[model samples]
Target chain A: IAGITQAPTSQILAAGRRMTLRCTQDMRHNAMYWYRQDLGLGLRLIHYSNTAGTTGKGEVPDGYSVSRANTDDFPLTLASAVPSQTSVYFCASSDTHSTGELFFGEGSRLTVL
Target chain B: AQSVTQLDSQVPVFEEAPVELRCNYSSSVSVYLFWYVQYPNQGLQLLLKYLSGSTLVKGINGFEAEFNKSQTSFHLRKPSVHIRDTAEYFCAVKRAGYALNFGKGTSLLVTP
Candidate 1:
């Protein structure tokens, strides 16, 4: 099963450009999240959606925005990509049962120059 | 809110040797703890989790962890390891209804 699928397995973007990391899950989960992985800094939450039509800011939401228009998609957009934003982005989803078992995508490696 | 600390950033051990990766968390309210393993170029996969009931949780890949409430620790352990076990291990925690807070991650290197 395609639990979670992300677009542009890797991308190279120029600074100040607009880019969106698309994430879709077929598990019909109620929660979705976006996280960035950087060296030494680990994984930091960017944005999240509790369910359809809802979104919330996470720990590191600056320069990023997300929308959950429906149950299957939660795409993260970088209004103005910066070099500092270059990192491996991961999309994850989980059920509302509270075990917090996240099903993650392979990841999108974004390089902002 | 909850925070996780994985004491070891890297661990090196010989094949078939037992290993333990330390993890500790702090939170005012109750927390759910998890351990995830990421193989090269792969997404993080569940190693095990401690929600409630049993303090000792056994997970896939013959890995298990014991949750210590007094010390606020949930350390992952394996009695004997294989080369396939070498990967990046992450310790994460979350208060109910919150995003998971991950540690810096520990890279496990298994040698022959």
Candidate 2:
């Protein structure tokens, strides 16, 4: 089974443009998350969903929004891309929300110019 | 609130040598700890985790971590390193059903 998959493997967007990064998981997990990885900063949480139809704000959720309409898919959208948003984005899911062990998808690298 | 700290930003070691990556965390309540590794241009993968069990937790790829409640630390260690072990390692903690709080990753470079 494909554990997790992210679409638009790489993208280049001009500043102020809108973009959406798609993520899907086959594990039927209840928890899904969005994170951005930058040099020397590690991965910072952008937003998360405890379960389908329920999303929460994370540490760094300024320019991004997420929706979890179904169990298998969660998408992150950037209303207006900025150079600061240029980073590798990752999607992750876990069988249970309480446990910290996560299954991650190959990242989507976005470059905003 | 929960936070994680990875003491080292970069570690350089020769193959066959033992290596340790230090990690410490702070939380108001009891929490679970985990270590994740990311290879070049790859997603993060679980290396190991500490739940309610023995202090020592062994994981895939000959890596292990010890959870010290008193010290508030979960340091990852491998007895012998290989060239394949070169990657960025992250320390993460979760408190009461919250998403993981990750520390600044430590890049490990295993040289031949």
lDDT for each residue of candidate 2 in B62-109, tens digit (9 for 90 to 100): 999999999999999999999999999999998767888899999999
For candidate 2 chain A, which ten residues in a row score worst on lDDT?
A: A94-103
The number of the candidate with the highest DockQ is 1
**Consecutive 10-residue window with the lowest summed lDDT within model 1 chain A:** A94-103
Residue pairs with clashing backbones, model 1: none
Candidate 1: residue A3 Cα off by (Å): 0.2
For model 2, what is the alpha-carbon lDDT of residue A98? 48
For residues A1-113, what per-residue lDDT tens digits would candidate 1 score against the true structure? 99999998999999999999999999999999999999888899999998899999999999999999999999999999999999999999999675878989999999999
Fill in the DockQ of model 2: 0.84
Query: What's the TM-score of chain B for every model shown?
Result: 0.98, 0.98
Q: Per-residue error at A97 for model 1, in Å?
A: 3.1
Task: Please give, for residues A33-79, the per-residue lDDT of candidate 2 as tens digits.
Answer: 99999998999999999999999999899999999999999999999
